[model samples]
Target: MPYAPSTVNQEQSRANEGPEAVRAAVGRARDAAPAWDALGHRERGARLLRWRRVMARRMDEIVALLESEAGKVRADALVELAAAFEHLGWAARHAGPVLRRRTVRSGPLMFHQRSTVEYRPYGVVGVIGPWNYPVHTPLGSVSYALAAGNAVVLKPSEHTPGTGRWLAETFAEAVPDMPVLGVVTGDGGTGAALCGAGVDKVAFTGSPGTGARVLAACAPSLTPVLLELGGKDALVVAGDADVEAAVEAALWGGCANAGQSCAGIERVYVAEGVYERFLDRITLRAPEITGGPGGDYGRMTVPAQLDVVRRHIDDALARGARAVVGGPGSVVPPYVTGPVVLADVPEDADAVREETFGPVLVVNRVRDAEEGVARANASAYGLGGAVFARRGGVRLAREMRTGMVSVNDALAFTAVGALPFGGRGRSGFGRIHGADGLREFAAPQAVTRRRFAPPLAIQTFARGPRDLARFERLLRRRGY
Candidate 1:
């Protein structure tokens, strides 16, 4: 469906947000960058603290908008909102230390000099957010960017534009004078414009195809980008594991956010010993799901996504797969897509191979833990995975070719606050959360101060023969 520009309400989005407005916003941010960066970390953190308080007070409003736009449940929407607050708090408290200069010891001959590295904020950051978990994902970039002293131009997903508006309005309440952070709303064109808007960097969260486009637009200007793309994450259940626990973990991991999460579990390889048991439990729980207004499940946010879900189901059924919960034509009232559990699915089916960002979970049996791990790793995405091995859960988690792995729980790494969240290969590169997130928006500057000139003065143009002899002796002592 084409996005009708007339339906876009400027008041609901923001005043002055057309192409010309976006250019102006970028210009304003660029002009404000030096002043914002000049504010030491402590001063910048005060603004973030005010924003955090605003988020806490108005969380219900945020959650309601999230549900209406993204078609998520109230509880799930709150989960997203709460995580955003926590992330903001973490960024505010830690950005100072993480970005502060730290002295590094200079060895021997250069010992008289003190070396340190300081992190400098990028001039301006362009953010492109997605519809799924709109607040949580975008705040990861926005909070870090702000804490690191970069002005931000955020372009939220077209599907959930209202949520973005709400966030921008809330922040405005806290920071009234400085338009340091501004929001732009539109279809892909606006995003393309932002990518080429001459911002120092761009942070985008979306599908692989769109991620590619964002990168291509940045190439001409040599602009840097952080792309958090798609994932076909897998779950491995080893033999002798707690079958019930594994099934529950898989259900939440696969169906949470209607399976729209980049880290949502899409595939499962179960060891032969517990395959049937796990399937039975998941089948029992899956059908009880309902989607609609005030329902457990919600319709896919993007209308085009429904077709993708249907196609994956059709491909599996045509290949002789049995649906333990929902069939191809299954539907519910309102916004719910309903939950689906497919068992005995062929490994090669589209449902197993591609990312069905819907309430669908595929289960296949494997010979052993090694086989399960092998099957889980056989994907183009390595964003997040899960393992339910009794004896070697940590070991198995370490072996998964993804950035994050939950041993007994599902998607718990995101809550840890200290663990870095990112992915490998097709899931995209770079990280958010923990110390890495603070560094993402800042550039490193190495500093060195010479307390006194060395007696030999080897760095000068007047280096003598005695310095060369001393350097050779040092290298020989170090076994070089």
Candidate 2:
């Protein structure tokens, strides 16, 4: 059994489920798959809405869970639950229309056939989730997969197993018929078991390194996988941008949730003209934003993450970057660090190239928005980014290579339930939280029915050269 690392009650540790737990959970999910799929979209959606109501009534309980299991602040916990609620509601309400069968024209070449395309549940879906934003991240896959009529067995991060179990149990209250959603909790072994447990599809969210491992685990079975991995997102501050708005965007986008958000702002590219002004506001503002169990943001969720953040900030400093907000001794003893802001970080430095995944922000001065856009696109990770500009914000945003970009705002793409959320390159592939998300768990099924007999009869082997000549002449008549 694995246990969550605790900030309090250090003497007591909570034991999590083992690898066998995941295998059994997947077996139960597979068994319930048929009944779950037969519910159809409308009925499934209704049941999901009921689950949403149950989740809403237990929001406070969920918030407390986040604080304990994930070391999340109450404020950030609420935000996480709220986003999860949004995705659940959207999936419940829209799965019907999004996954229903659709008529498709066969075109003139196949005029005799009536064609249609539809989506069918893949039966059992295995979801491997992350610890950051524990509720919101896993629910993105669980809710959507459920709404699309698939029974799901989730292997949530061992760090936040209790929180993940709460979601599964509460969902049961809304839908008690069968185990529509099941949770398996442990370390990587449990997750690996789920990937090879004969699931039709697997949706995983985590680092590229872990994602690669998950990919390799599922390779023997050739199970279809959907990966929502990490990101080193960037923020571009234009010279003509509203300085105050940009500052707020950077502060909230970069530091909120302890900067643990996968799509959150990790780096900033500010235009030379207003670089000092932006830095001035940030330097003064950051020291005021406190953390560690009683402040603006939450403490570091994972203790090991502290080392990564320290290493990045230290590397940036060693590379000649200056910290206007927090310098050395920034990483608190046990589990706390950032809203640290480093200025003039080199483009190729570790802090710039890698995903620090802490509240630290690397701000570098650029010639203009164009250069900022170019620098932002240079990262190996292209999950999400933001640009602030008055004249050409959209154009600049479009120029970046990220999957999602916010113009004159910060991480706005996540708030909109309709937009697909995923990325390219090292950030991983596939999506969650949109029409695309609903379909990701379901397989496309195309149906063809012969509507009439064709005059040419070209498909028959009995046809001779006369039949071929006749078909050729008809094709010529049709301007083929």
Candidate 2 positional error at 296, Å: 0.5
When summed lDDT is taken over every stretch of 10 residues in candidate 2, the lowest stretch is 4-13
**TM-scores of the models, in the order given:** 0.95, 0.95
C-alpha lDDT values of all predictions: 0.83, 0.86
lDDT of 1 by residue, 34-140 (tens): 88788889988888889889878987677767766777788788788778888888888889899998998888768889999989998899999999988999989
Off by over 4 Å in 2: 1-20, 474-480
- Top lDDT: which candidate number? 2
Q: Give residue 452's lDDT in candidate 2 (0 to 100).
A: 92
TM-score of 1: 0.95
- Total clashes for model 2: 0
Score candidate 2 by lDDT: 0.86
Tell me the alpha-carbon RMSD of every candidate: 3.1, 3.2
Cα lDDT for residue 218, candidate 1: 94
lDDT, candidate 1, equals 0.83
